[model samples]
Target: AQSVTQLDSQVPVFEEAPVELRCNYSSSVSVYLFWYVQYPNQGLQLLLKYLSGSTLVKGINGFEAEFNKSQTSFHLRKPSVHISDTAEYFCAVRAFYNTDKLIFGTGTRLQVFP
Candidate 1:
């Protein structure tokens, strides 16, 4: 079984400031990691993913994450966040064979204040 853990349930940051969302995972076998965002009244959408290749993976909306295997972490970060970036972020992991099902974290609500 695979599981994800979001270190912070809520993150408050001022507009145009750099922000980082912490994510950790637990899995007996290798798994694919992902970051998804959900806007108000909207379903989740993929933000980024770590399938293979480079350890540093870039995502949509100016987001990027680094996959640290030893640490079992895939923390999301942005150079400077805008107010529109406010949304609920989830960290997920699934086996390479299983792409449809995702083990998600509790989710972190990013509040970007003006």
Candidate 2:
């Protein structure tokens, strides 16, 4: 079985501060990892994804993640965050070359303050 773990349940940070949302996965098969964000009363939006190619994958909203095969980790990082960045961040993974089912973490709430 494959699972995802989010190190922090909640992260509070002042505006313009750097933030890193830790995520680690356990899988016996090859996997594709992803990061998604959900704002208050909004749906989940894709932050970044690691399908193939480079280890460093960049996505919208100034977010990026590096896929570490050895560590079995895909941590999301933002150099600076804004008040608008406050939301719930999720780490998900899907079995490579398999079903569309996605395994998600418990989620980390990013609370950005002024």
In terms of lDDT, which candidate is strongest?
Answer: 1
- Per-candidate clash tally: 0, 0
Candidate 2 overall lDDT versus native:
0.96
Error of 1 at 28 (Å): 0.9
Cα lDDT tens digits for candidate 1, 1-114: 888999999999999999999999999988999999999999999999999999999999999999999999999999999999999999999988875889999999999999
Assess each prediction's global lDDT (C-alpha) against the native.
Answer: 0.96, 0.96
Runs of candidate 2 exceeding 4 Å displacement: none
| Alpha carbon RMSD to native, model 2 | 0.7
Model 1: which residue pairs collide?
Answer: none
After the best TM-score superposition of candidate 2, give how far the Cα of residue 54 lies from its true spot, in angstroms. Answer: 0.2
Candidate 2, poorest ten consecutive residues by summed lDDT:
93-102
Superposing all C-alpha atoms, what RMSD in Å does each candidate have to the true structure? 0.8, 0.7
Per-candidate TM vs. native?
0.97, 0.97
lDDT of 2 by residue, 28-96 (tens): 999999999999999998999999999999999899999999999999999999999999999999999
